[model samples]
Target: MSDAQYTLPKTNSGPWNTRPFHRQWLMRQANNLFDFFEAASLNPKGGFFELDDAGKPLDGANSTRQIHGTTRMVHCAAIGSLIGRPGSGEILDHGMQYIWNQHRDTRRGGYVWSLDNGGVKDGSKQAYGHAFVLLAASSAKLVGHPLADQMLADVTEVINTRFWDASRGAVKDEYTSDWSKLLPYRGQNANMHMTEALMAAFEATGNKDYLTKAEAIAKLIIAEHAASLGYRVAEHFDENWVLDKNYLGNEMFRPAGTTPGHWLEWARLLIQLWVLGEKRLHWLTDAARHLFRAAIDLGWDKVHGGFFYTLDWDNKPVMREKLWWPLAEGIGAASFLTSYDRDDYFQIWYRKLWDFADNHMIDHARGGWLSELKEDLTPTSRLFVGKPDIYHALQACLIPLYPANGSLTKGIIEADHTAKIAH
Candidate 1:
């Protein structure tokens, strides 16, 4: 396909696409999440508490504080403050402080995977968690958190030196805290998130280098790996970045076969990367649309309205349960397409996905969205314990309210600037 072919035609939008009520609705959804997580997430000792189904703090010391949760909490709060939510600064500051004080490996170099009451719960360093560290730090920096500068610089150094595999145009998978015994495994999930973090870093710092790495990773994964595989988004790979079809390391994190959700995620991330790159890469938008269509084709439950958690090599559902994050990602992808292409196809999906989330996944009375649902679209807890996170759902609401070309941080800042000009 020629580069010009990627100039997808824009058109008149429908109510779902251009309605004023939807923007207000999106803001209300975002604020609901901000209020929910902010009220219950903080742990006095260091990071966030593990909340149960009712939003009550679950017993910690018994479990672990994964780096993703802590970092995402900071990210969620940073975006909150960007939207002018009061008390969000404290949440962002507290989470950033906890990340440095607890998750950072002072003994070694990189951040650890998880933490307990005393210290290091699981000391292994993972690209996935570190990617979020970069994301959170970039977000905190965007909001002017006091610790943002040091945290951002520290994580940037760790990612560049440790995880980044310059040869493959992507990052490596995992390592021990001592920085020895590197895991031979490679996966796109971490790298997918790294693309997101890199974009956030670019938006926060105006660093073209971050965009360079982001474009490399997006090309390697979406334009190359995913394109070759019918845009299915292979989850696991060997050290050489070769697909591991039989690799099912963990049911939750590394389930067997392709994760449809990541397809939606990469779709949006690819669009953002392309936008940030000034649309020089025509293939990024094309691949993003392909990935979005593939997610709906292979991941969506036909009999149901939500997306499946995983699918086998045969394209049949492996983990048939519906997940909240996929719906969140689907909303994100659809909304971006709605904004970018302005076509009713994507605009329709945007409303449909959000409608499905509202009907099934969102627990209106309980505060945050339900984390899991049965294949039939009823709430289920077989996979998750409680209302674990607000990042995905929160972003689902906020992304559509902002520009398609930037992170929520940039979106917030730009919107505020525009408002000031209007005033």
Candidate 2:
């Protein structure tokens, strides 16, 4: 068929679309491009260097601002997995060495979250940081690192000692330096990321324990936060699971009055878990269905081409701006939905997302992708976008890997036509 007449196949349920050749190329390029982001943190002493705005090393002696060594370690592991590199293993090794040498709290049995830019552990132990360490350890295993197994054990030890809450059936959000629980705080975002980290750990070790933990977390999310209208994940919560409403500010564009990024990420993970043939297919399927329905109904910008940043719980648009990470998640969700069941609207949504990113997020005049954009598809901020984070590029590169469904492609082409007319 001619290019103009090309159309993809359709499935009976869910969304579908045709995969393009450029999708594979995009993924490869993204993998290569983001490799540098991971490499720049390497230090000769088996510890990664934390760089400041000027690219100078920030150690405790040099700067007062603390850096989370866990973040650097996680970035290495993630980037390594994406690029098929041994560098990720090295980064993890270095990070572990630093933790062993300086950050470890022997009395507490968990790594502290931050040290002065110089590598001194002076901060509290954060659930988010520990989660990243778990993720990195899992990723290190993927790259053939021998220490990865021990790292996984360390993950379990840390969680057990400091974060895991048997009564709540979920992990606590944070702890003081001495491992005491920090009250009046739990977070949906932290739970979501922890679930993802656990999933990775399960994948790496073939351990049923990790998978079990992941499922438990997923169940808690469904039971507590997953709502009928939308999955309302909050920024903060009291120890008893009460959401802190004061943190809800109108300053940033919040689509549907919630963070779309978290929702999309959860949806993507649920779909992945379902595909993994885990025990919770029903839960996974329900999550995928609800998240996509809610995201589309609430997160999407009807007047514009892309998704907004946040929305209220009632599905009204709260944040009007589009962010790059959400676009990546949108592609992931659309791809998965299309795979499970083909629908014209899903195809249209995917196409609109790509078009919006191409027009707004991509820096044609400069280089790399822009992090955020205005509702009119213009650049709103360059802070995160221009810097080239590895995660965004890696997700962006996966577009071509999705199987092309004919009906979805046709829907996309038609959507392009509609967008032109509306313009």
Candidate 3:
């Protein structure tokens, strides 16, 4: 490795603070990843392709175009475009067209989970994918995509009418393609993403309804569901919003037991809610801090330097494999907390997180982060192959550089204008 490649960031690099240096470094890293993903992942027709370690398409022509992946690509592309990155608008438009043409269920009224060359590989309507659709549209709208407003409107209608549970203040997990029957399970995973999507929608449209819904879901997860379970956020739930800790609905997405990565994710999202709520909600910040601590204490493996994939109800490591998303979320949560409060604890954690990611997760040879690792930090593809999407890792690098008091889209917009003024 080059001397610059694996060097750990020091907390005391300067007399005052090394945060500014960290910010500049993070911007370069985020931009490099933005360019890398745009170049390697976009399919010719539109949308993105999941690539293997060698940067080759995993599925060739018959690759399954996932709604979540497509939306995440658009989200990253929108950020890149807003930040004045060259060639970003092309990828943004490509993702937008792919979603509108291929993913959206024209007659059924919701996005399908996946599409292959033969079309409609998994036609089941998933709230997770739909939430990403909302997020993508919201982001595209911010960057001034031509169809973003209409797309946001359509997605909002679908989510409200089909996935939302009016009484429970949470979103349902899944539905049949025709929207005839709700699925048997409910999930905080989907609700968490829904909260993220709603926040982005609120930013894009100034829709108070979106903000209100996002806050409601945040409370449901952090205040109620997580509080009841000692702040270890439950992933699966029953139809009535009761926790189902033993449920393994989907091996990849809704695995059984609590996911520490999600707890950290909620921490960051709660911080966002606290900020956009005009700091009126004091509990949101408190809940965010609590969630961060809970994840660190319960999920981090002392023997191993990374967070475990899943923890059982008693806090034992359920799946010992370390995944990349948790560390990304950890960096975000710690950076956000440190930015808001100037807490040295979060600063230390943030530096440690970057160090861990630099030493283990980053693919020095290829350019994207490796997605999964063994407990010993060796590259492993048990759950994920190559780099599926850049959303989480890119945000991990960029969100830390911006002020913690607004949505990421808002921060990027402000930074973009500031850069233009500087030029």
Candidate 4:
């Protein structure tokens, strides 16, 4: 940790605001992630392919693609297009076309959960997937895709009518296609993402409704629920929106215990939400701080250099495997905290996170990030196979490069605008 590679950033111990080397380093890393995914993610079939650890499409992979998976690639591709990554517009165009043509359930209305070989694999509509749809539409709108307006409008309508529970200040979970039953399950993960998508939508369109909905969700989930639970960011819930402390469903999405990574994610997002709200909102920044602190104190492996995936109520690690996205989220959260408050706390964690990623999570030989590591900091694939998705990793690299006041798209556009005027 004391070596030059992991040393504290900057020429002096002053504020990192003036530092350029780390931002430049972040740009390089961001470009590497974008290149790795862009070169191999496009699946001329419909959506993007799942890339292996070496950044190639997984062999014998089922042509099945989750809607969130497709939408995230589109969202990241829009970021690429905005940043002038070559052939990015094509990626943007390809993804938008796929989502409109294949993912959408034209007869039923909202998007389907998953597709296989261009057909519906799971006709179940999920709030999680639709939130990503809104996110993809918002990012595409930012990049000026031709279908962006129509797609955004359509997804927004679907969300408002099908998913939004105005009474609860959040969205309901899953539904069968044809707009059937609402599953008894309710979860914060979908609402967390909806907060993210809503902010992006607001950024792209200046729609205060989106921002208002986002704030409500944040208040309900973070300010009310997680705050009551000590900022651990509860994952599972019942229909009445009460915490289902014993509920354990899927290992990947709806795991049993609290996911610290999501706390880190919410920490970064709350800052963005507060800034996007023109800093008019109260309690968001403080909540962000608490969430960040809780994740670090409860989740990080003090014996090692990575975060445990999940933890029980007693603050013990439940799923002990180290995951990549948590570290990615941690750095983004750290960058935002560092930017808004002059606290060295976030700046310090930001560097330490990068150190961990550089030494353990990044596959320098393969040109993409390693998906997971054991508690001992060795690479493992039990939980995440391949470089599952680039959204988290890409944002982790790019978020630190720009001001944390708005969504990443806004950060890129405004920063680029400033750069152009400066030159």
* Candidate 1 least-lDDT 10 residues: 1-10
Candidate 3 global Cα RMSD: 4.0
TM-score, each model? 0.95, 0.76, 0.94, 0.96
> What TM-score quantifies how close candidate 2 is to the native fold?
0.76
Q: Which consecutive 10 residues in model 3 have the weakest lDDT in total?
A: 1-10
* Local distance difference test, each candidate: 0.86, 0.60, 0.85, 0.88
Q: Residues 1-423, candidate 3: write the lDDT tens digits.
A: 422134334646321223577678788789768766888898886678998876778988778898999999999889888777899999999999999988999997989999887788889999999999999999999989998998999999999998888798889888888888888798898999999999999988888999999989988888887887788998887888777777876668978898999999999999898888888989988888888888888898787789999999989998989898999999989877876764456766777788999899888777888889999989999899878888999999888766676778888787667878999
* Native-referenced Cα lDDT, model 3: 0.85
lDDT of 3 at 365: 74
Per-residue alpha-carbon lDDT of candidate 1 for residues 5-63, written as tens digits (9 for 90 to 100):
33333453464535688888888888888778886888877788878878888775445
Candidate 4, poorest ten consecutive residues by summed lDDT: 1-10
User: Which tens-of-lDDT digit does each residue in 120-194 have in candidate 4?
Assistant: 889998999999999999999988889999999999999999899999899999888987688999999999999
* Candidate 3, residue 332: how far the Cα is off, in Å: 0.7
Misplaced by over 4 Å in model 3 are 1-20, 417-423
For TM-score, candidate 1 versus 2, the one ahead is: 1
Off by over 4 Å in 4: 1-11, 15-17, 59-62
